[model samples]
Target: MSLLAARDLAVARGGLRAVEGVSFTLDAGQALILRGPNGIGKTTLLRTLAGLQAPVAGEVAGDDIAYAGHADGLKPALTVAENLHFWSAIFGGPPIDAALSAMNLTELARRPAHALSAGQKRRLGLARLIVTGRKVWLLDEPTVSLDAASVALFADMLRGHLGQGGAALIATHIELGLDAQVLDLTPYRATIRPPTSRPAGFNEAFA
Candidate 1:
C-alpha cells in the first residue's frame, strides 16, 4: 500500500474551502512538497493529514504520522530537552539527543522554551519528527523562523528521514532540500469553481 495517500480530500476554514477534491499518493521513502500562497490550505491540509484537524470531507491513509505545524507546538515553560522528552513520552519513543546535537541545540537543551528565540522554538518542535519513530510525517512550514544554519540542519535531517525510508508531506514556501515532488494545489482550484465542488473522480486528473 502507498505510505501516504489523500483520496478526495476536502478541507475548509471559516467557510473557505482550502482544499477540494485534492488527492495524492506517496510511496515509502518519498516526499511530497505542498506549495501555495499563504492562507491557501497548506496548514489545513497538513493538519488534516496529521489527524489534528478533522477533514470536512475525505480521509488520509497512512501509518501513525508525526506532525509539526506552523505553531511551535511547544510549552514555553519547559526546557527544550524537556519538550522533546514530553513528545517522546507521548509517542512512546526514544530520546532525541542525536537530533538535538544535529541542530546544535545541545547547549540550549536546559533553557526554558520561552527563553529561546523563534528559530530555537522551531528547531525544538522539529526534534519530535526525529524521535517520533513514525513512518510518515506531516509538516506545515517546518522551517519558519529558522536561521540559515538551522535551516541547513533542518534540510540535513530531512535527508536522513528520507534515507531511512520515511515519507513526508511538507507544506511550506521554504525549500526542504529533499528534492521533493511538488504537489501544487493551484491547478486544482479555478476561478469559475466555488472550491466546494468535488473533483471529478480521481482518474489521474491531478497526477
Candidate 2:
C-alpha cells in the first residue's frame, strides 16, 4: 500500500506559485526523489508533505513522517547518546543503541554533539529515526557534507529502512542508489527565465 500520496497538490508563496498540479504516491519500501530548479519548491513541497506548509490546493495523505532538513537539528551541548534519547523520547520509537551502532556512532556515544564533525552530526540526526521507527521519512539533502564512507553508511541505513516496509521522500542532488522516480517540476513553468544549462542545477528555477 502507499504510505504517502499527494493528489493535485498546489503551493503558492507570496502570491507566486512554486508548485502546481503536483501529485504522486510513495508506497512502503518505495522512494520518490524530487528534482527541480531551486525556487521550483523542493523544500516547499517537503514542508507541505510534512504538514509544515499548507498547500493552496490538492491533498497529502499518509501517516506521520520523520522530517529531517539541512541542519539535522542536533543540540550542540548534548552528547550523542543524550541527543538520541531526547529525540526518541519526544518522537517515540524503537531502541536507539542499535541504530547508533549501525551508523558507526558506537565510540562517540558519550561525546557532545558539538564536538562531532559535520558528518558525525548528520549521522546522529539520522539515528533519531532508528529510535522513532517512523515509516515515512522525508529527508532533505541527506548527503550534504558527508565523506564517501559516511555516505555509504547513510545509504545502508536507508536501505534497511526500506527493506522493513518503510518509505522515503528525499530531496537530494546526490545519488542515493535507490530506485527512485525523479519528479521534476520544471515542465509546469509558464516562464522560467534565462533557462539554466548546467546539469543537476535544481536551484536555477529561482533565477
Candidate 3:
C-alpha cells in the first residue's frame, strides 16, 4: 500500500499558486527526491505534504508523518537527549537511546542544543524524527549544513529507516547516496507573477 499519495495537488504561497497539477505516490521502503532550483516551489510542496499548509487544490493522503523543515527544530536550552525525549513522548515511537545512537549523537547527548555546531544540531533534529517512529519522513534541505561524513551518516540512517518499512520525501539539491525516484520539479514550476509596485532600486536593496 502507498504510504503517502498526492493527487493533482496545487500549493500556494501568499495567495499565489506555486505548485500546480502535481501528483505522486510513495510506498513503504521508498524514497522520492524533489529537485529544482530556488523559487520553484519545492519547499512549498513539502510543506503542503507535511500538513503545515493547505493545498490550493487536490488532496494529500497519509498519516503519521514526521516533517523536518529547513530549520532544525530544537530547543536552545534543552540537551540533545532531552530534545529527542520530548518528541518521543509526543509521538510514541522509538527509545531515546536508539535515536541518539542512530544519528551518532550519544557523545553530545548531554550538551545543550545551542552549544552544538550546525551539523550537530541538524543531526539532533533528524534524530527527533527517528524517535517518533513515524512511517513517513518529510524533509526539506536536510543536508543543509552537514559535511561529507555527516551526510554519509544521514544516508545510513535513511537506509535503516527504509529497511523498517518507512518512506521518505526529500527536497534537496545535492545527492545523498540513496536510491530514490528523482522528481525534477522544473516541469511543474508555477508561473509566478512579478511584484506589482516595488521601488526601482528595491531589487538590489538586499543584495
Candidate 4:
C-alpha cells in the first residue's frame, strides 16, 4: 500500500517556486532519497511533505509522519533523555530506552543537549523518529555532522526502520547506504518568481 504520495506538486520558498511538476509514491518499507544542488528545493519539498508548509500546487496525501529538519529540535537546557521523553509523550510512543540504544546514546543520556557534540545532537534528533512511532519519516540533511562510524550506525537504524514496515524520504548529499530510489529535483526546478509576487506582511508598506 502507498503510505505517502505527491502528485504534480509545486513547492515555494518565499515567493519563488523551487520545485514543480514533482510526483512520487512511497510505500511501506520503501525509501526515497532526494538529490539536488544547493537552493534546488530539496528542503522545500521535504517541508511540504512534512506539512510544515502548504504546497503551491498539486496534492500530498499522508498522515502520522515524523519530520526531522536541519535543526536537532532539542532544548539546549534539557538532558538528552529528557528531550526524547518530551517528544515521546507528545507522539505517544514507546519509552526512550530503545531510541537511546539505537542511537548509541545510552552513555550520554543524562548529558544536557547543549553539551553534546554536533553528531550527538543529530543522533538525538534522529532518535525522535523512533520514539514517535510514526511510520513515515521526512529527514533533511540527517547526516550533517555524523562521522563515518556514526553514519554506519545511522544506516543500520534506518535499515531496521524499513524492515519494520516504515518508510522514509530523506534529502541528503551523502549516501546513507539505504539503497533508496533517487529522486533528483534538478529537473523539476521552477523559474524564479518576479519581485511583485513576493509575500509581504501587513506591517510592510504597500507599493
Candidate 5:
C-alpha cells in the first residue's frame, strides 16, 4: 500500500496559489525528490503536506508523517542526547542510541545543542527524524549546512529508513546519490492571481 498520496493539490504562498495540479504517491521503501527553482513554492507545498498550513485545494491523505524544515527544531539548551530523548518520548519512538549512532552524534551526545557547530547541529536536527518513528518523512532542504561526509551519512540513514519500509519526500538542491524518483514542480506552477483581501489581523508577510 502507498504510504502517502497527494491528488490535484494546490498550495499557496503569501495568499496566492503558487503550485497546483500536483499529484503523486509514495510507497513503502520509496523516496521521492522534489525538484524546483527557488521561490517555486516547494517549501509551501511541503508545509501543506506536513499540515503546517492548509492547502488551497486538493488533498494529502496519509498519517504518521514527520516534517523537518530549514530550522533544526532543536532546543538550544538541551544536549544532543536530551533533544533526541525528548522527541522519542513525544513520538513514542525507540531508543535514542541508534539515532545517535546513525547521525554520528554518539561522540557529542552529552554536548549541549548550542555548543555544536552548524553541521553538527544540522545532523542533530536530522537525527530527530529517526526518533520520531514515523512512517513518512517530509523534508525541506534537509541538507543545508551539512558537509559532504555528513550528507553521505544522511543518505545512508535514508537508505536504512527505506529498507525498513518507510517513505520520504525531500526537497533538496544537491544530489544525495539515492535511487529515488524526481518530480519537477515547473509543470505544476500555478498562474499568479490578483491579491485578495485578508482577514482581520492576517499577516501575508509570514504566510
Candidate 6:
C-alpha cells in the first residue's frame, strides 16, 4: 500500500483556490518531487498534506508524516543536540547520534542554535526529520540556505531514508540527483474565483 496518497486534492492560498484536481501516491522506497512556478501553491499544497491547514476539497489519506517547511523550526536558545533530543523524545524516535552524523551536525552538537549560520540552521531543521521516526516526509524548499556540499549531504540522507522503506514528497527547485518522479502543479492551477474563507490571518502569498 502507499505510505501516503492524495486524491482529487484541491488546496487554496490566500483564501483563493490555487491548485486542484491533484492525485498522487507515494510508496515505500520512493520519492516524488513537486514542480511548478512560484505562486502555484506548492507550499500551500504541502501545508495541506502536512495537516498544518485544511484542504479545500478532496482527501489526503495515510499518516506517519513529518513536514519541514521554509522555517527552521528551531528554538534559538537550544543547542543542536538538545534540539534533536527534544524532537526525538516528542516523536518517540531513535537517539540523536545518527541524525547528527547524517546532517553533519556532530561537530556542532554543543553550539546554540542562534550561533549557527543560516545553512547550519537549515541543516539542523532538516535533521529533525531523521528523529521524527515517521514513515513519510513532506518537505518544501528543504534546500534553502544549504550550500552545494550541504545539499549533497541532504541528498544522501534522503536516499538513506528511501532505501530504508521511507517515502518522501518534496517541493524543490534544484535537482537533488535522486531517482524520483515529478508531479507538476501547473495543470492543476485553479482559475480565478471568489475568495474562500481561510484562517483568520493566513496568506498564501507568503506560503
Ranked by TM-score from best down, the candidates are 5, 6, 4, 3, 2, 1
* Per-residue C-alpha lDDT of model 2 across residues 7-95, encoded as one tens digit per residue: 98877665456777887999988888888777777887888888886777789999769888877878899899999988888877776
TM-score of 3: 0.91
2 versus 3: better TM-score goes to: 3
Separately for all candidates shown, the number of backbone clashes (residues 3 or more apart, or on different chains) is 0, 4, 0, 0, 0, 1
CA lDDT, candidate 1, residue 187:
65
Candidate 2: worst 10 consecutive residues by lDDT?
198-207
Misplaced by over 4 Å in model 4 are 192-207
**Which lDDT tens digits does candidate 1 get at residues 26-56?**
8878889988877677877887787876777
TM-score of each: 0.86, 0.88, 0.91, 0.92, 0.93, 0.93
Candidate 1 Cα misplacement greater than 4 A, ranges: 190-207
**For model 5, how does the per-residue alpha-carbon lDDT over 16-123 read when each residue is reduced to its tens digit?**
789999999999999999999999999999999999998888899998999999998899899999999999999999999999999999999999999999999999
Scored against the true structure, residue 46 in model 1 reaches a CA lDDT of 82
lDDT of 6 by residue, 139-205 (tens): 9999999999999999999999999999999999999999999999999999774446445565664
lDDT of each: 0.80, 0.82, 0.89, 0.91, 0.93, 0.94
lDDT of 5: 0.93
Identify the superior model by TM-score, candidate 4 or candidate 6: 6
Q: Candidate 3: where are CA atoms >4 Å away?
A: 192-207
Model 6's TM-score against the true structure: 0.93
Residue 99 lDDT (model 4): 94
